[model samples]
Target: MHMDEYELEREASAPIDMLETYYRALGWEYERSGEDEIVSTFQGSWTQYELRSIWRAEDQVLQFLALPDIRVATEKRDAIYETIGLINEQLWLGHFELWSASGLVLFRHAALLEGEDGATLSLQQAETLVEAAIEECERFYPVFQFVLWADKTPQEAIAAALIETQGEA
Candidate 1:
């Protein structure tokens, strides 16, 4: 079930199409780089990110990735490695990691729609996963910055990032 053939089934738009439509409604620009993949950009307060998604129909998996422009300096890889454990502990959905080969740090999450009795992927599901990934990336962006640029210890970075919050009274 390749993405190209998935759209031909039932004469209706496929899951990938719905996913693209979801992004369109959010007013984000995207490009389909392959039959199963799309790339989009999102702007956060700290920086902009290139977000890529790949729909794997055979596996019934939709994977989303958000990559910031900064690279983990060769010397700083150890620091990021130490910090990721703490960051991942607090994350509910996805985890951040350094792509060792490229020295790139990226946030990744996936939605698995397999084996749920006749369940089909929907726009809502795609939007929910994507929104969560974006939010997760933004929330933890500062932690990476703390380690990569500010030379904060992993413990210090996590403690600072995990401070309790209060709502407006």
Candidate 2:
């Protein structure tokens, strides 16, 4: 998909359409609910992720969220929050957050549409944004799991997630 194909016709519409095309090219399952919102699914090695791309015309920003299949119980929120903080510090592109209301751990990022001439959005940028979200989420998924189920401390979970290993070497 090219920028011209995904160029915002009105600052509000068309971006989502471009996103739809992009996801389609990748053979990912997706549903476009509206001109500004899209829901997609990605099956990763660790888990299935629910991906969302929302375009806010008023703010001229695009929000991307990749949610792995994990939930934080009420008793686990404190530890999960701490782990998220540590994980976020290690991140350069997007950040992980706990959606308190839903108790869902999700990776979120926002891209600012830098111009007024109907925002030139390229597929490459979109892919980078989406990839960052999913990669970060997959990278630290075990951190959340260790804290919630294995009862590991935040520091320990972060350390486990960061350990370098040559598996099967």
In lDDT terms, which candidate is top?
A: 2
**Clash pairs, model 1 backbone:** none
lDDT of 1: 0.75
Global lDDT scores for all candidate models: 0.75, 0.81
Q: Residue 129 error for model 1, in Å?
A: 1.2
Compared with the true structure, what per-residue lDDT tens digits does model 1 show for residues 1-169? 3344334333324556766766676788999977688888889877998989888888878788888776988899899988888778888888888899999888888877665453255655776777787787777777787787788898887666656211211
Once fitted onto the true fold, the runs of candidate 2 whose alpha carbons sit more than 4 angstroms away are 1-13, 164-169
Task: State the lDDT of candidate 2 residue by residue for 24-98, as single tens digits.
Answer: 778888988878899999988689999998999888888998999888889999888888888888899988888
What would the TM-scores of all predictions be?
A: 0.82, 0.87
Best-matching candidate per TM-score: 2
lDDT of 1 at 90: 82
